[model samples]
Target: MITLLLSSHAQRIWGERIAVAVPPGTLSFLTAEEALAAEGPSAADIAFMTREVTGKSSPSHPTPELRGFDAVVEKSPNLKWLQIHPAGAERPIYRQLRARGVKVTTASGATAVTVAHSTLGAVIAINRRFPLLADAQRRHAWEPRLAERSPRDLAGQCAVIVGMGPIGRNIASLLGMLGMRTIGVRRTAEPVEPCERVVAYEQLHEVLPQADWLILCCPASPVTRGIANAAAFAAMPEGAHLINVARGEIAVEQDVIAVLQSGKLAGAYLDVFEREPLDAASPLWDLPNVLVSPHTASHSLGQNEAIFGIFLDNLARFRAGQALRNDVDNLG
Candidate 1:
């Protein structure tokens, strides 16, 4: 028998489907809490967990004394695979899992459509000054000049998208429909359909000045941490917008704040922050030109359903001894 552990919430959402799909007596379900509390040894063969269940900064349950996914993995002696619901797996966590000889998979493409839609919405909101208009409405001030508040159109604009992954490609396609040209940047200058042209990392600076919008959709890696720094801001044209739907550590917060304060960039739509829950006193919260979301760009009504589908399909692959989809490269 193969024991599959899931969070109480995940079990509620996908339990029935999983039970129906897997052969009888071949699988058993255990809530994350139950699995973590198990004594001595664990019968679990696979674990499906989200960052929340893994505990971002601490263990999920105080009694069990597990201090994050690493602790959970340490206890589950029979665990062979881990499926993370999020697209980007934290480097440290990935390393720990790999060291234990456990394979990790991510739900990378599952949230692509929702995240891409959010990116497109942010681009339009920044260009059209939607926040400013909303503020005007809140104050009950009918300012006629609001229409002239530097609102720009998407048509004929140039967008430079960093990272040519599934989310990036979807954003490019949506922007293309608005008549915007997209230039994709990746490690290799491979041909991506939604992009007008794809360039390597070395050419990022060369194309920055021509972009009306710059979007970051890359995963967080050693090479990507703080990739967008002061020099990158200086290379962009004044009044250009930035949208970050990728990991927060990819851009330096202080540099972004400085550029936004100096009006070097018109605005920024940030869905993630270097430090999550974004310090209560952070100036980015008060910036008129900035739109901040609490790292919910990938959230949608269908998110759970979509992620469950990915996990379900991967379960079949695991049973058949086939390679899992969206397997983490585990470079560390």
Candidate 2:
């Protein structure tokens, strides 16, 4: 039997589905707490976790009751594979897992559609001056200035999508449906569909001035960390909207604030922040031109099921000794 250690949140969300996917007596499901307490030979063979499970706190129990994922990994000697719900894995944890020769997989494309939809929504909200209208509504006042400003339309507008991954491609396709021109950027300039043009990372500056909207959908890596800084902001055309559905570390917060302050950017929609639970004292909360979403862009009614489906497919592949989908390439 394949012993799988599942996070309590996963169990709560997709326990029935998981049980049905893996036939009776073929796989044993153990909560993280249970796996940590298991004896040598009874330890888990696979760990299915979310970002919460990898955190400093335990998702199943209080911190005092259970140690974090590192401890779980150390205790579960039989663990052979790990499936993380998030697209990117923490470098340290990934390195340790790699050293142990454990195969790792990620839920990369599972939330693409949701995240892409959120990005397009943000673009439209900013262009249509939703923030101004929302502020006016709070005071029970009718605002004609919103209309006087001549809200921009998506038609004929240009959008630069950084990363060109599944999320970026989905965003490009959605934007294209609205008559917006989509240009994609990646490490290589390899052409991708739905994007009118795809350019290399080195050409980002060349295309920045042409974009009415700049959407960040890149993965967070050492090379990409803080790629959006003062120089990048300065290269963009004035009043261009910024949408970040990717990691907050991809953009420098201080630079973003500076650009907003100088009116270089018309507005920004940020779903993620450099520091999560974004400090209440941070100026971003008070910025009139910025919309903050507490990193919930990927949330939707069926998000859990979509992610679990990836796991189910991989489980089938595992049983058949086939290569898993969305396998993580170890970063050297």
Candidate 3:
């Protein structure tokens, strides 16, 4: 029987569905403890892991020895696939698994719908001054005139969406449905949904100034780290709203702070941060013009189940000798 080791979070969904999906495989939930107990290489045929398990658990970072219960697939003769739960596979374990000849897949488009909706809400909230309205409510004061003070209409606005991946394309679709002019930027400038114009990365500077809204949806890779800086922000039109649903490291936090302070940008809505669990004393919390969420914009109901469904489908493909869906092809 093929052995499947499932992490706790994936246990409820993938573990349950995979049982029905892979009847020949023996599915077992391995706690961090059970995983480490094996004498030699992994006794299992396949392991489904979340990036959190690979990085957060003890003996973090999968090694050749399969030490600390974190199984190294290709390193061990018995294991074959190392399926990761998150869309981004820039972690160390991914490389280790690939080098060892183990196949890797990801849940790339699972969170697209929810993440796109959240991005839309963030864009609208920042443009409409939702924070100011909430503050007005806290004071128990009527401020009908405040809405007039900052009137930014979503319709007719030009949004430049960066990345044009699943999340970016979804954001563009939503923005388009709202009657906004959608622009997309990709590495190769391919056609994407709801985008009237798709431009290459080289044209970013030219497009930045024309955008009334800038949405960041790119993954935080080595190529995109700190891609948004002082010059990029300066290139945007004064009073433009910035929405970041992408990795915080993509933007220079200091540069964003400077722009907001100078009134060059109308506002910003940030879901991710360079430093997670944003420190209690951080000034970002007090920035009146900025709206911050604790990286929760993409979280929604049934996320675990959705992630599992993808895993189950991919697992079937693995056994059938077919190309797996959402396979990570970073090396290429």
Candidate 4:
């Protein structure tokens, strides 16, 4: 029997689904709540660290209780596999889990459409001057940006998308539907669909001058951390907008603020941040040119079921002794 370990939050909502997926008598459950109890399951072969944290969880912030369960898992000498929700696994907990010989798989592709849709919306809103319009609405003032200061057509404008992962590709495909051009950057420069061409990370600066919009959807790898800094922003065409749906460490917060202040970037939409629940006193909150979301760009009605599906599918594969999908055990 495959002994499964999971969160009480997850098991409560998904207990029936889990039972249906795994054959009767083939699986047993030990909730995280029970695992944390003085007398818990002595050993677990698999862990499903799921959460219902829509607005409460940020990619940078794991649920407090869930994060604490790592110790319980480590002591389970038989644990061989685990599943996580976040697309990126840069968090230290993941590293620690991997080091303990657990095969960590993630729900990376689940958020693609939702994240891309929100990112594209941010682009359109900023282009249409929604922030200024919102402020005007609050003051009951009549102010229209027409003629001289009117927004230009998005067609023919270039976008430099970092990462080229599921999220980046979806954003590129949507941008193509809008008649926009796209350039992708990642480990290799090979061309991907929708994007006219692709460039290696080493060539990022070479393509920045063409960007009307710079979207970050890359992983938080060593090469990606803090890649968007002052020097990088200066290479962009003036008035370029930055939309970061990727990890926050990829963009230096202070440096981003500096460029925004200097008008090097026309605006920015940041979902993930270097810090979760971004400091209330942080200028990002008050910046007229910035749009901040509490890492909720990926939140949607179907997201929970989507992630659960990945887990169930992988659970079937695990039961069959086959390789798992979205496995990042060997990844950095």
Better of 1 and 2 by TM-score: 1
Query: What are the per-residue Cα lDDT tens digits for candidate 2 across 1-332?
Result: 98888777777877788788876988877787665566554377987776455443322222432354556766777888888777666446766886788888888898999998898888888888888789889989887754558777789999999988789999999999999999998988889998989998888999998988889998887767888889998889888888988888889999998988888999999988787767799888878768999778888877766777788888889888988888776322
RMSD of each: 2.8, 3.2, 3.6, 1.9
Q: Which runs of model 4 end up more than 4 angstroms from their true locations?
A: 39-41, 53-63, 330-332
- Please tell me which model should have the higher lDDT, number 1 or number 3: 1
The sequence of per-residue lDDT tens digits that candidate 4 reaches over residues 225-331 is 98999889989998899999898889999999988888888889999899898989998887775899988889898988999999999999998989999889644
Score each candidate by Cα lDDT.
Answer: 0.82, 0.81, 0.74, 0.86
Q: Which stretches of candidate 3 lie over 4 Å from their true place?
A: 12-14, 25-32, 50-77, 146-148, 330-332
Model 3, range 1-332, lDDT digits (tens) per residue? 66676655556544555677666444555544455555655666677775445432222234333344344343356667867767766657677777777788878788888889998887777777788778889999787745448577789999999888788889988888888999898786778877999987778888998889888888777767787789988898988988888887888888888888888888888887777766688777877668888776667766656777787788788888888887776423
Report the C-alpha displacement of residue 119, candidate 4, in angstroms.
0.6
Off by over 4 Å in 1: 51-70, 145-150, 330-332
Candidate 2 clashes: the total is 0
Candidate 3 residue 67 C-alpha distance from true site, Å: 11
Error of 1 at 214 (Å): 1.1
How close is every model to the real structure, measured as TM-score? 0.92, 0.90, 0.88, 0.95
- C-alpha lDDT of residue 107 in model 1: 89
Full-model lDDT, candidate 2: 0.81
State residue 79's C-alpha deviation in candidate 1, in Å: 1.7
Model 4: what TM-score?
A: 0.95
Q: Which candidate would rank higher by lDDT, 2 or 3? A: 2
- lDDT string for model 1 (1-332, tens) is 88897777777867888998988889998776675666666677898875456443321222232243346666787888988888877657666776788888988888899999999888888887777777889899786544556577779999999988889999999999999999999888888987999998778898998888889999887777887889988988888888899988889999999989889988899988887778899989888768999788998878777877888888999999998888886322
